[model samples]
Target: MNTPAALTLEAPAEHPFAPFVRILGKGKRGARNLTREEAREAMGMLLEDKVEDTQLGAFLMLLRHKEESAEEMAGFTEAVRERLTAPAIQVDIDWPTYAGKKRHLPWYLLAAKCLAQNGVRIFMHGGGAHTAGRLYSEQLLDALAIPLCRNWQSVNEALDTGNLAFMPLQDWAPHLQSMIDLRNTLGLRSPIHSLARILNPLGARCGLQSIFHPGYQSVHREASSLLGDNSIVIKGDGGEVEINPDTLSHLYGTTAGVGWDEEWPALSARRHVKPASLQPEHLLALWRAEVEDSYPQLALLSTMALALRGLGTPREQAFEQAQRFWDNRDTSI
Candidate 1:
């Protein structure tokens, strides 16, 4: 009998990226986290645009469901860092502001400005407002007169003159930015959110990250250790890197490949009510001391103290220094 027409054709080869998806989606028993090497290769392919859209979505959602492991995060970060062209400027702190503030003003912006004024060179990076109803850093940049850099040349200029610079992720890392933009399509944040926070692209000495989700703090801490990064991960207010004065915040950190943890006592004896609305103008007013709200002041100082601690200052000294910086801030901004 003649062979059927179907027998004449060959089966298509497996996709290069399918293995990664399989590793994460191989069912409850067979599924497992991607090894560091596998993750690096997988992310490398994604960054290189070799992944199909279907595979990309599947991979992201699968990883999101599984929750990325330290190995995976460290590996993914390695792949990105390898591709980034860091500026030749030195930075004291690597502040990743991917999570926009929803409940309160971005007090961390004021805290960063205070640190910058005191000679701390900070590199702040964030994505656009992929999620709605949050106040993003870029929105307040013009009001605060902080330079919004579009390229390395501008970043160099901003850091040189102001000791601080803000760059949106799309300006430098468009590939990752595209992934972050999928929040609405995917209906949930992918690993890109957490991975971007730990990138520390300029390789700063101190990396500060804040996560809203519980348990992920230790994941970030452990991932930083794998990368030999000196980092502090906290459950900050509204998921931005600003400490809440009303809650006792736990700090998960790593230094020189060693892991450690600390607790910062709440600055307030009682919980403060959330603002009826988040006003970006309040950030500028708070900085100018035009409005002397106690909650914002505590929020700013406590956030600054957390940054200082990441820079290796002792706990008490960091708090004192933060207070001093706030008290002596130049109101003429």
Candidate 2:
């Protein structure tokens, strides 16, 4: 009878991300932090889909609750940078938009456009609808007639055409996007939320990061510095990278190993009134010169100033150049 051919089987090996999950999930005293290299390996497994769904979910939640370290963030960013398929295109500024704007119309989009018009090559990346009721960059970019690049080739083509390109986060980091999409189900964000903000996929000379939470401002600064990144992290308008016209902005970051930070006071003499509702057309109107609201214009000016500084302009001169660039921007484009 051959005894049913002597059944043979092998147990599946433990998932690559399991160790990370264990380190973070072990009871308070047992749990420990992952080193930079360990963080990198874990993130690589996530990007490569080498972890089980249950393991991935648990790992993310543990990381979220434990709070990520600068070492972990830098390591995850390193993994992302390594996986980026985009050609080494020369990008002057890397604008990573992850936090959605609820109270504003993403004036930073216009800021980037203005800079691009003045000859700075801008590469913007972001995800859509991760948070409910918040306005994302993709929606605004669509309204403004900017094409969305879904892959590296398209990003290069868009960059070549307009000196600006907006890539959706899902295109380069689908796994991270999956975690972001779990916002509603998870009822809380994971560390991927912060990591996505500082990925800088194309290795641009300067990166702009927007943080909604004040505590994260320091995390971003330390992580970016560890990665040798020339970048700025701002508590932007609704955390969308638009300098708030009504509040002082605490900027934290590094440029050529020189730590950079400042409390840029608000531009308005009186607190600006929040609009009843935000519309993409409002941004269009502002750019088209059909609307002349001081608040939005000041937002554009201040945001551009930071970008210019990130690009190596002196503090005083950056604002001046930003004003000039805003004035000369061909809004008709």
The model with the greatest TM-score is 1
Q: Write the per-residue lDDT of candidate 1 for residues 1-333, one digit (tens) a residue.
A: 986576466899999899899989999999999999999999999999998999999999999998999999999999998898875679889999998988889989889999999999999999989899898998889888788999988998999999999999999899999999999999999999999999998888899999889988999899999999999999988889999999899999888879998998998999888989987777777788888898889998998998899889988999999999999999777
The lDDT per prediction is 0.91, 0.85
| Candidate 2 ranges with C-alpha deviation above 4 Å | 1-16
- What's model 2's lDDT at 119? 85
Q: List model 2 lDDT by residue over 1-333, tens digit each.
A: 556676688999886567888898889899998999999999998888888888888988888888899899999989888886667788999988888888767888898888888888999988787787998888777777676988888888888888899988888888889988887788898888888888888888988898888697898899888988898999888877788978888889788645778788888889988888987888889899997998889998999998988888876899999999888878794
Worst ten in a row by lDDT for model 2: 253-262
Please state the error at residue 4 of candidate 2 in Å. Answer: 24
lDDT score at residue 311, model 1, on the 0-100 scale? 85
lDDT of candidate 1 at residue 309, scale 0 to 100: 93
The number of clashing residue pairs in model 2 is: 0
